[model samples]
Target chain A: MSQILRREAIYALTGLVTVLMLLEYFFWPTAQPWAETIRTWAIIVFNISLGLGAIRLLMQQSMNVQKRRENWQYSAMLLSLFVVMLLTGFAGYFATGLQTSNGIYNWLFINIYTPLGATLYPITGFYIFSAAYRAFRARNVDAALMLIAGCFVMLKNAPVGEAIWIGFATIGNWFQFTGQIPGMRTFSIVGALGLIAYGFRALMGKERGFYAGGE
Target chain B: MWDVIGLWIGWLLMLMIYSYPLYKENPAFRTAEHMFIGVTLAISIITNFSNVMRMCVTPLMQGNILMIVPLVLGLMIFSMLIPEYQWVSRYPIGLLVGTGFGLGIRGTIKPNLQDAIIDTITAPTSGGAMAWFNFLYVAVGLICSIMYFMLTFEHKGPLQGPTRIGRLFIMVGLGGYFGNTVLFRFTMLTGRAQFFLQVLKLIPM
Candidate 1:
């Protein structure tokens, strides 16, 4: 009974919703409202999943702090900050909607969160350069081609490359559109096919690990 | 006063984040990582909480019987906390998966597949000879790349050459991608640098 309710019933639900959604789009346009309602409910459920994640994190962090695990101090720090921000955000949300432009939540988000994000993102510039240094080594034909192409593109990006010669920009632009477009397009085509296949599998309830959390 | 304090804290935190590459794994870096995650999750939690309240909870409170379904489903997610009731969480997951997959499959049909096929076929169009050449090049590249992804066939005789050409296209594509990414990273660095300079009064705001 337990297995039937959890696995078979869940599969049925999944198949039903998927069929309804596809039908709404392809065959029965009148089912659009029902489809939209399901979509909205899915989104709401997804949002609620975030809370589930928080609860999991809270449990893990509390356990870590309790057991004095490695980097437990960091876990403690995370919990404190999480609680602080959680309270402030919830408190400010009723006062100001979405916490975008103005509010205590936005203030914290902008000043503290924004700076951390900004700095961390740009720091990748350094790492990429380091990566380029290693990866650009032309040990073979493929590597050499990529290196040559990469150099031209990098040169085109820099002001001095176009200043010295317009050919750099031309070649760079050529590589970007001609080289990238076909490969990317093919990838997307293959990817879309794969997505449909996955969707089909889910509809059939053959793919079990996704909904059951690897059970 | 609060604004000024916030600015200073932000700048200091920015400096701490920047310290990661310079100093390696350290307390400051870990602190920033923890703080960033904590605040981010908090934001997500708050936004979702607000959404649930506004969309479902409030409606249900006001006698909207339909809202009860979602509200109950949302609460059911809390079953994940108990090992015995963990399977109960599958209900919401199933709904989410169904809608997501259904919409995804629906979206791909005309937009991704049909349009892409159209572009492939109509690529060699009535333009200058150079335009024709470019289109031909992309068309061939597209075919070759797709051929490379064919799993059933062994790349032994005739298939090997096209697959090789496909790999070359992919390499060139990666190179171009790398260049674009580098340009982006440089742009990001420049913005951060400008921000730093402005904060220090070395440049005009």
Candidate 2:
């Protein structure tokens, strides 16, 4: 196609697709059959994506093993665990007869995955403490204020602050409830708008990054 | 039984990789990093597709032609993948943006502006000093945060005080961010450790 023709086709396609999506969003049919059909296609694509992920995991593990990398052992372990999980999950589905018992997949997910996932958040305490020690310097007026506010909030988050200064607890609560929360909300709203705009530009084929020849 | 032993060994191996980052950048660490990124991306794709098919695609396919809207919009996202046909992504992007803006405006107008304004105006003093401090916090925090965004003009005689207050609020905000980062990092460390501990002992199970 000619340059102008390509551009026109792209724009027209994007515009048409956009209209369809907007229409669908506003006037979603209240019928169950339509919902089910949509659900099937979504699952098929998602499953294909999952299979791709498993392949990626296997590839990385193989690479690590070949290179004899130090953490190669870990990579191997990850692949093994993933395979086991995948197998057990599939097996359990097929052998639905033994579904009542503590199936292999269920046990592993609850005991292993659940704890590991939950710990991800709580484990940040060390990094936070170390980072604070390194970066909490009051190099400027703004930095100083940040340090003070951060300290206050940190203290207030825990019971120790209340023990040290009764006012700290209340102050922390007020800062979060009044200041921090509202500020973050505004930032999120503005950030989301920017994200949507960028997403649109990308989808319209306006995004040069997606092009094989980088613009 | 074999799986159990393998899981324990895997946990140990993962912990070792996690520790490599604290020491120095090494092949082991890099390998672990690559593996993590690859696995996570893959899983996310799978889960999302599973959910979309279950919730969206299947419904439309089974005589629910109306459900074609989001699917087509979503597929339009792939126009970005087609190099020559990439401009098709714009349609979905536009739809996403329009809906996002609508939802955001609807959600934000009342809570962010209206409620905040009302709270600022209705200062309370029922709890003595504590209440006074809270009232001041609301007043100052609102004004200062807003003032910080005022870049249209330079701060001069009258604007100096508000500008200074804005700077102060900003500092406070930065501090909060620092604290959060520190907390997050520590959490990562704890997570690695917990993984090791859980594998070493069956108690966590």
**Winning candidate number (DockQ):** 1
- Candidate 1 structure quality by residue, lDDT tens digits, B1-205: 8877787788788778888887777889889888888888887887788888888788789997887787778789889888888899999988988888888999998877899978877855466897888888888888898888887899879999999998887777777888888999989999888888877879987
TM-score of chain B of each: 0.91, 0.85
* Local accuracy of candidate 2 as per-residue lDDT tens digits, B1-205: 7667657645744654555535765765555454444434433443455466666666777887766766665665655556677655554544444344334434455565666577766868588987777677657765766665566777877888887776676566666665556545655665666667777784584
Q: How high a TM-score does candidate 2 get?
A: 0.66
For candidate 2, the lDDT comes to: 0.57
List clashing residue pairs in candidate 1: none
- Kindly give the stretch of ten consecutive residues in candidate 1 chain A with the minimal lDDT sum: A94-103
Off by over 4 Å in 2: A1-127, A162-215, B180-195, B202-205
Task: Report the number of the highest-TM-score candidate.
Answer: 1
- Which candidate comes out best when scored by lDDT? 1
Residue range with the least summed lDDT across 10 consecutive positions in model 1 chain B: B118-127
> lDDT tens digits, residues A21-42, model 1?
9999899999998988888788
